[model samples]
Target: MKIVKVEEFDLRREVEYGSAEQNEAVRTIVSDVKKEGDAALLRYTEKFDGVCLEPAGLRVTQEELQAAYSQVEPSFVEAISAAAANIRAFHLRQKRNSWMDLQPDGSLLGQIIRPLKRVGVYVPGGKAAYPSSVLMNVIPAQVAGVPEIVMVTPPATGGKAGIDPYILVAAAEAGVHEIYRVGGAQAVAALAYGTDTIEPVDKICGPGNIYVALAKREVYGVVDIDSIAGPSEIAVLADDSADPAYVAADLLSQAEHDEMASAILVTPSEAFAKACQAEVERQLAELPRRDIARASIRDYGAVILVDSVEAGIGVINKLAPEHFELIVEEPMAYLGLIENAGAIFLGPYSSEPVGDYFAGPNHIIPTNGTARFSSPVDVDDFIKKSSLIYYSKEALLQNGATIVELARREGLEGHARAIEIRLLKEGKAGTNNDNQ
Candidate 1:
């Protein structure tokens, strides 16, 4: 890790739109799935995942969901159940009801909120299988009252059939019964446009590799996606009071995710910055994914020097990090200064992994600088809102002339006539038809 002045450090990477070859491949796969349906879906599954399967074996049976419980230990089930309860309880608070306001003229205006009819959650298999993510994606949609929730993962992970046992158990625990044995671009296409074995969903959620991200981008307009996630990142805003070892460990937690992941520290104390830099080097060697973490630290990790902790907050706002940690002596005092962060962890005990696993908040957050605009996934992601208006005769008669005047000023005669015709039918039109 390098130490530099705050002005000298620049860690932002260009947005990944994928290469032409990858984009072309995703386009071809999506087109094939749209045209050939299940046959194309199965072919790609075999080619990409090296798993061959018949059409009859596409969907995971209820027996498999039940059997998955036996493959995992009792402790695993108990832990996940507890985590699920916490996640459910947290998201339930975000649930909203439809509301209406009656006007004095007998008109009604309201917003109707409803969950998407169906949702598809894509859980990665192989080396990146995370049961924690299964709960993060599924529980929020369930809280939003989505009727049909389906899950799609690769057929085999580490050369084992029926996917990973932990993933199956997580899905079953999350109350998702519709599991499919397909993955990659083909699976994303199948979720967007229904195949013989699978049904189309209104939205898709969860994380995957670059190929899956490109696939999600391809099918975005046809079906909504959670977000095209980038590599994991962490930014620690700490002071001399913070322990260097804990800071270094927390930074490496995100760095191990991939070589592109970034780990950064911002502080006023140059001595504290140097201490953390040394601690990061010491800890990097012990990580099982040290090779990946080492590259991440060497390429993207840094300790930025600031005039004061207040100055550090300004730099962090510009960076708009995905995960932010405030390890200062008085963390709460600086909370209001933070304006851009996907998830804010205050104090030493609130580590990033806590939210990733047992914590109630959704771990699927905006990455890169996207935290400036977007947010972490919550109950709102799975629901849609429609504006409702019931205009009574009195209300329309009173406002119709003003509406026509505004419409006609914009050179939209059709809009003006729309209000005028109604006013005339209701016997409330003024003597001047144009004004009405």
Candidate 2:
């Protein structure tokens, strides 16, 4: 990792989501799925995942879900269950109900909150199992009362013929019954456009590689997506009093995610920065994913020397990291100063992994610089809101003139006349334009 003074260091680090060729590849996959449906879905699944299946074999069967229990150990089951419980409990608080407000004029105005009828959650598989993602994506939608939840994953996980047993168990634990063995841009396309085998979903949620991200971007309007997530990143804001070991270890946690992942450290004290940099070197040597972490730390990691922790906060806001760890004294005092970041971790004890797994908050967060505008996945992602307005005869008669005048001013004759007819019938058409 390169160490530089914050004042002199360039803040610009380009986030590589994918190249144009990658986006075009994803677009073509999406287009094929849209046009060919199940036939195209099967071809792409076989082409990319090396697994060929019939239409009927696309969906995971009840027998497979049952068999998954026998394959995994009891301890693994216990741990996944505990994690699922925490996730479910947290999202249940975000549940919303349809509400209305009554007025004196016998008019009812309110917002109706409705859970999306069907939702699709994409879990990354095929040599990588993300039971955590399965829990994070499905629990919120379930809390929102979504009737049906469809899950799609790569055809083969760890080069096996079937899905990972742990992933299946996790999805089953989260109350997601419909699991499909398909992945990549084609699965996203299928979820958006629908096929005879897989029905279209109202929204798609979860993280994947650049292909998955670009696929979600391609089918965004056809189906809503959580966000076009970039690679994982973490920024540590520390002071002289912070522990160098803890800060360095946390930075390495994110750095090991991928070669594109970023792990940055910003501190006021030059000595502390040097100490943490050394600790990172020591820890990185032992990490099993050292090559990946080394590349990430080498290419993207940095130690920035800021004048003060407050000044460091300014740089953090500009970066808008997926995870921000404040390892200084009185961390909460500076919480309000942080304007961007998907999730904020205060104090040395509150590690980033805590929130990623056991914590109730969803781990699916905004990535790259998107934390400035986007938010973590939550119950709101699985529901829709419609404004309700009930106009009684008296209310319409009382407000008709004002409505007609505004409509006429906008040159919408049809709208003005619609209000005009009501006012004339109510014998209130003669009222003054502004006051009415």
Candidate 3:
């Protein structure tokens, strides 16, 4: 690892940026699915997932789920159950209540909160089985009182038409209504534009490869989607007191995610920065995914030696990292100064994986500097709000002339006429100049 002084501007772009080829491929997949429906989905699944699945048999059945449960160890199932309980408990606090307010002039204003009719959660399957993602995605929708929560993942090889046992168990614990074995851009298309077997969803949420992100972008108008996620990233803000080993391990945790993932360290101590760098090299050599982590660190990772803690904080806010860990003397001291970040981990014990798996926070976070304007998935993602308004006759009479006058000024005669006709029918306004 190399340590460099912080600069005001770094012109080089990160390699993790999405490509035009991916966007075009996603567009093609979405179009094909829209035209051929289930047939297109089956064909793409075979091509990408290396599994042949008929549309009718795509959905996972209760019997299959039971078999999956039987395949997994009881201890792993217990852990999944525990994690689900914690995730559910945390998101339940985010639940919103509908409210109405009455005005003195016989007017009522309020907002009604309702869960979306249905939602689709995409979980990646294959070499990586994310049972934790299943919990994070489904638990929030369940907490928001969503009636139907459907999940989709790519089918495994050898005629396996369902998710791994851990994923299935987690989905069950999170109250998912349905699960399907479909993957990639085609899965996104199926969720966005319902096929014969898969029901259309009002919204889709999850993380996936570049194709998945692009597919979500193309289908955005047809169905609401979570953010277009990029590769995972983490930024550690530390001082002299921070432990180098802990810092290095935390950085590698995200770096190992992919060759494009970024791991940055912003520290005030030059000695600590060097120690972290050395420790990162030592630890990377021992990781099973060392090749991926080494490439990620060499390409996108950074260790900036800032002049002061304030400067470190400024750099963090500028980066708007997906996962931010504060390993300073007082991690909470600079909490108020952080204006942007998908999630913040305080103190040495709060590792990034804590929130990724067992912690209540949603791990489906915004990446690639999107945290400046976006937020992690939460209960609100599964719910919609409608503003309610009611005006009594007295209230209408009180404001009708002013409304008409405003409409007339805007040259919208129909708008003025609509109010004028109503007021005239009630005998409240005989002439526009009566009050004047």
Please, what is the whole-model Cα lDDT of each candidate in the order they appear? Answer: 0.91, 0.90, 0.87
TM-score top scorer: 1
Worst 10 residues of 1 by lDDT: 427-436
List the candidates' TM-scores in order.
Answer: 0.97, 0.96, 0.95
lDDT tens string, model 3, 163-252? 777788777767774888898999999999999888899999998888888889889989999888888899999998888999999999
Candidate number with the higher TM-score (1 or 3): 1
Candidate 2 residue-wise lDDT at 133? 92
lDDT of 1 by residue, 67-169 (tens): 9888999999999999999999999999999999999999999999999999999999877789999999999999999999999998784334577889999
Cα lDDT, model 2, residue 224: 94
Model 3, C-alpha of 91: deviation from truth (Å): 0.7
Q: Across residues 29-99, which tens digit of lDDT does each residue of candidate 2 receive?
A: 99999999999999988788778788999999989998999999999889889998998899888888889
lDDT of 3 at 358: 90
lDDT of 3 at 366: 87
Give the Å error, residue 283, model 1.
1.5
